[model samples]
Target: MTATPAIEGWFTTGDQPALIGERCTTCATSYFPPTAAAAGFCRNPRCEGTEFEQVELSRRGTVWSYTDTRYQPPPPYSAPEPFAPFGLAAVELPEGIVVLGQVAAGYGPDDLRVGMHVELVVEPEHTGEALIWRWKPLAEGSAA
Candidate 1:
């Protein structure tokens, strides 16, 4: 797909795509790609008995780490011939969870930083079957 397709009922505003996740009721921990059921346990031992509740994630976060994929990824990830490198970043959300995703098209290491703020976005993969989550640098004057 030339543009990302929304996963129905996942994001708050379908047009502004986001990753799906869940929050633990007991310890307030969050998970990416939401757990399969509501009765999931928290990773933290003190809150192991908590149940996860589906929730929309914050659109903004600070970069926690980053890396690049210089070679073609195995099946499942589609890349055109002469495969160019793609960036990956781990972002720390407001609720204290870190989410990893690819960087949005046109962004490179020069435009990223460990503590820099970024906003979550979705981009359609070249294969046209799924929407991939990505991150973009937050606008200079925008609040994180």
Candidate 2:
């Protein structure tokens, strides 16, 4: 059987890539992947907000945390046989939100830092099925 495609329509602007999330019109809190359920309320109790509007996130953020997967992930995540380890990271957006995604291939943990600026990138699926999100170092001297 072929693999299922991941969520669609979740893309940053092609020219200047940035994570896209939804902002609560009432409370002003933002969320990634644009929450679909009513449970998308802002965490701030004082606001008790609803109504999210699509918002483009800041292009750059510091590395908040990270890890590497040494083993192959089960079914839903397709990987070639004799799977190689991949890097996973939690990047802190300028909006104060942390987003989790894969680190761009060719970079390793040694290349990362807790406060290094990184930009979002959409990579082709090696397995030929889904689109994957990854983070890469912003070009030197370029504002993210």
Candidate 3:
């Protein structure tokens, strides 16, 4: 099946994957799911600069936290029949940002540990089959 991003411009898929974000030219603050940096000033209260640059976020990070979803979500989100629990993780990247995403296949909360290394991967979205970012645990002895 052909795959497309549920939300365009959020990320790109290939041999390497990275999230797209916007960085403020003045304060170095960044925003994910890239916004209209040209339309407004930086998010920092102390900086009033209006220019921003698009940047690719780090692909590797450490698992900051994780959890399991035993229940399905509300509308706009359609779970498969006889839904099974899945895992979620909050990863802290070298960029000083923490991002939340679903765990990759075969992974659950039990498979995660705080400070464990992880890397970004693209997988099909549960509800729409669109490409989305997921966190996969890095194999021991492997470098991200």
Maximum-TM-score candidate: 3
Give TM per candidate.
0.82, 0.83, 0.91
The 10-residue segment with the lowest total lDDT in model 3: 30-39
Q: How well is each residue in 31-120 modelled by candidate 2, as lDDT tens digits?
A: 787773357567657776766788888877888998888889999777877788878879998777899988887876667777777888
Clashing residue pairs in candidate 1, if any? 1-128
Model 3 lDDT tens row, 25-114: 888887776874856877678889799889999899998999999898879777788888899999988877789999998889999988
Q: Is candidate 2 or candidate 3 better by TM-score?
A: 3
Clashing pairs in 2: none
Q: Report RMSD for candidate 1.
A: 2.8
Ranking by lDDT: 3, 1, 2
Model 1 lDDT, full chain set: 0.76
- For model 2, the superposed segments whose C-alpha errors exceed 4 Å read 1-5, 36-40, 139-144
Give the top-scoring candidate (lDDT): 3
Clash count list over all predictions: 1, 0, 0
Cα lDDT computed for each candidate against the true fold: 0.76, 0.74, 0.86
Please state the error at residue 50 of candidate 2 in Å: 1.8
* TM-score between model 3 and native: 0.91
